[model samples]
Target chain A: EPEVTQTPSHQVTQMGQEVILRCVPISNHLYFYWYRQILGQKVEFLVSFYNNEISEKSEIFDDQFSVERPDGSNFTLKIRSTKLEDSAMYFCANPEGVGYGYTFGSGTRLTVV
Target chain B: AQTVTQSQPEMSVQEAETVTLSCTYDTSESNYYLFWYKQPPSRQMILVIRQEAYKQQNATENRFSVNFQKAAKSFSLKISDSQLGDTAMYFCAFMRPSGTYKYIFGTGTRLKVLA
Candidate 1:
């Protein structure tokens, strides 16, 4: 099975630093998404991207956050200025298609100190 | 807005036995998709099973199956012949066939398979 790959399984950074998370979605997938799960909490949607543009984003996806397909195969999320509250496991996903379910990456654990 | 609820915070079952996890959702959309995902100690989210609202027949895959009641807004997962590998945090999720492609997930149910 094709898998979504996320780099930097774990990352620790200063509270005010900038961080970039990378993901390589399934080769044939058209839609990509970013979600975060705080410790012991529900997974929350952050944003969705397709056709090299952001399709939609949740309120949690604010000015501090931005996503880019940068290339045909790589999707990246950049947090301009991280806050302590930014500590969480961020997952990149590819639904593959409209009716298919999501295939999530192993996740990048961002630890903002 | 759609919300998925997994009422059971935690559950335990003996190895080789069977167990069921309950899930319910609130959605006004007539057509949508439901899914059950498992997150093991590795914290990797894995897709366990999925069901389409338009299909009255339940969906099953290997040892995992789902009881989907569209009218009641209920979707439950049944694990038969459970194994230690089945111990994980199970989450129920909802998504509509729209442009956003965002998935709304439940708080999660932690299941323990004991020997």
Candidate 2:
């Protein structure tokens, strides 16, 4: 079982501030995903990246949200201007492939003040 | 568009007893997959069980099992001889076999196992 590590286990940022959540990608996996879960709510898919491009994204992924494999090793999700509603647990996931389930990072708890 | 529904917001079961969690989904596609993920207090998503849409037989993992009714579009999880460690938020999810393979998750059922 490979691991997807997320940095800054917990982050606190002021509203309107820019925030970037990082995920260390698995060496051989090409598909990566970002999901968010508000406190006591269901987890929702944000976006999926494949071969260095956005493959699919949900409506929740507005202009404010962007994902990139900036250095080919680290996958990052950037929120241009955070809102109080953006406060949630952001998780990075790597799917082993078809039929195999995903491996999710412990998560980054983003707190917007 | 695919949606997973977990009608039970919370449930409790006594240790060593059996309990079942219900899930229903709406999808037009015939080929897909269903999953049950357990999120503990730590908030790590753990895969509890999976069932392929085409398979008629139920899928099970140790104490966890799924009764997948493809015709009814219903997937239910049954835990036997439940343990205290089973306390967590259980989310039922749906995934397409192709495309981006992104997951559509239900709100979740918070289960508590009492001693």
Candidate 3:
């Protein structure tokens, strides 16, 4: 079966450094999203993208965070300056564009020191 | 706002036994979607099963099935003949039926299958 794939399975960065987590969603899907899960915490929504633009976002998706569909298959999340609290597993998910079930990627584990 | 709650933080079952994981949600919108996802140690999210709020009939996939109660706003997953590979963190999620519906996931129920 076709599955979403993310690059950099694990990443470690300094608290003030920048990091980019990437994902390639299923080809036919239309909607894309980013969610973060702090260790032992609930996954929180960050942002959702479609038509190369942000559709909706949560409070947690603040100025420090941004998402880009730089290319047809590539969706990325960039953190301008990482914070220690930013450490968490970032998941990329896609829904059946028009409307439907969600399928998530393996996740990129971001660790800030 | 939609919230999914998975009461049991953890559960254990024998390899061949049956196990039920409970889930509940708060949503007044008559149209929506309920889902159960499995996240293994690899942290890969896998879609297990889904139910449409409007459909009274529950959804089942092989040994994995769900008991969806629309009136009570409850959706539980039942795994029959569980196997060692069934061990994982099970998450119950909710989404709007149409429009821009992002998923709201529960903390998750960790299941350990003992042989």
Q: How accurately is candidate 1 docked according to DockQ?
A: 0.84
Candidate 3: tens digits of C-alpha lDDT, residues A1-113: 66888889999999999999999998866678899988766778889877677989999999999988777779989999999999999999887543356778889999999
Root-mean-square deviation of every model: 1.1, 0.7, 1.4
DockQ of each: 0.84, 0.85, 0.65
Candidate 2 wrong stretches, greater than 4 Å:
none
Point out where model 1 deviates above 4 Å: none
For model 3, the interface Cα RMSD in angstroms equals 1.7
Candidate 1 C-alpha error for residue A82, in Å: 1.1
**Candidate 3: CAPRI quality band:** medium
> What TM-scores do the predictions have?
0.97, 0.98, 0.95
* Candidate with the greatest TM-score versus the true structure: 2
Clashing pairs in 1: none
The C-alpha stretches of model 3 lying farther than 4 A from their native spots are A97-100
Query: How would you encode candidate 2's per-residue C-alpha lDDT over B1-115 as one tens digit per residue?
Result: 8889999999999999999999999999988989999999999999999999999999989999999998899999999999999999999999999999899999999999999
lDDT of the structure predicted as candidate 1: 0.92
Residue pairs with clashing backbones, model 2? none
lDDT per residue (tens digit) for residues B67-89 in model 3? 99998999999999999999999
Worst 10 residues of 1 chain A by lDDT: A94-103
Q: Write the candidate numbers in order of decreasing TM-score.
A: 2, 1, 3
Native contact recovery (fnat) for each candidate is: 0.84, 0.72, 0.56
